[model samples]
Target: MVVALFNLVSALAGCVLLVVAGGDSVGMPNEWLARTPFPSWAWPGLILGVIVGGTQLVALIAQRRRYVLAWGPHAASGLVMMIWIFVEIAPLLVWSPLHGVYFLTELVQTVLAVLALGAWPQPFFARMPRRSRTGVGNTTDTPA
Candidate 1:
């Protein structure tokens, strides 16, 4: 429950970051034409915000003891968030010229968000017992 709340909060924060960052430049047609000059961080941040927000929101709604869509997307989004964090950090570490305080800030935020999602309690479906070959529920036997 606590983890879910954390994820929700983090998702909201991500959305705020997206709005403050000026959204995705690539999403704007004029960007490709070079008519508008937006920071490179805009696009990736916006993408990350949407993905993370959607995932967390779904998880939160599902946690409320309601029907949840596929858990696959939620898990995938968590993984994507981690990947996005790496993507954000890579340039800063590989290219000294890109060093900035914002890089570290993003790193911390991403780490926190990942930790929150990791700590969330497993859904009942995830913890449910599987059926054995004999057609009985197998709570302890490992599948071969």
Candidate 2:
């Protein structure tokens, strides 16, 4: 439950960042992303944010299912967010003559993504059964 909420928050935050940092007018962190070659990638990031955030929202609705389909989308979106942050965003922030705000925001968002994935209920929640493995063959209870 907590993981989902964190993911949702992070996704929303990321979306806001992408929207606000659409162009190169700003400086440092914000401008860093905007200056990247494929400026259009921001749109994908925004879409990913919506997907991740929506996944969490659905998780809340389907609590009793033990596992929800949202997990896959959440994980994919997280990966995309990480790629954008590290590959495109980080370089600019690191090399450019920018302030620390961009780095700090990146750090916080990274932590949130880590926590969300680490705390996810379980990857196999839906496919696996609850029963424990006995590891005993009915034909031969004794060791061969």
Candidate 3:
């Protein structure tokens, strides 16, 4: 559910970016792309809407439908978000609080997806006590 909401927001934002031709409309300056390959916001906007947003859409659908290995798409979308931010900011050499916020959001998404994959001991939300695992918190067989 959390990932779905994030995906919706991201997709909407991306679509908006793609629709708007100028960076000024989005509070960005055309100068930012002076040192980069993009002559205008069109390419970035397309990439954001199609690549980043599309990935999120896929993740959301996979999760909602309970597809096989649904967590895989979630994890991939998280990585795509992170990479998109990095690539977007790297070329422009610009930074903003929004970037940090989105990066953290993606990080959380990735962690949650990993947790959903049953990477650790089983029954994460079970009411029963947690037992020790090899090389984990407690080595003993007793519950913690």
Winner by TM-score? 3
- Collision count for each candidate, in order: 0, 0, 0
Task: Write model 3 residue lDDT over 1-144, tens digit each, in one string.
Answer: 585467658756766775674687877888888878887878887778788888788888887888987888888888988998898888778898989888888888888888888776666554544545654454544554
Worst 10 residues of 3 by lDDT: 135-144
Best by lDDT: 3
| Cα lDDT of model 2 by residue, 1-144, tens digit | 465556567667666766666433233344454556545546745674665566555654454364644444444444544454466445564544222334344345445545555665565454433333674434433333
Name the regions of candidate 1 deviating beyond 4 angstroms: 21-40, 68-74, 94-144
Q: Which stretches of candidate 3 lie over 4 Å from their true place?
A: 122-144
lDDT of 1 by residue, 36-135 (tens): 2345445544665677656656655664654444343445545555565566445433333322333443344445555545655566345545777898
Q: Which model is ahead, 2 or 3, in terms of lDDT?
A: 3
TM-score of each: 0.43, 0.41, 0.78
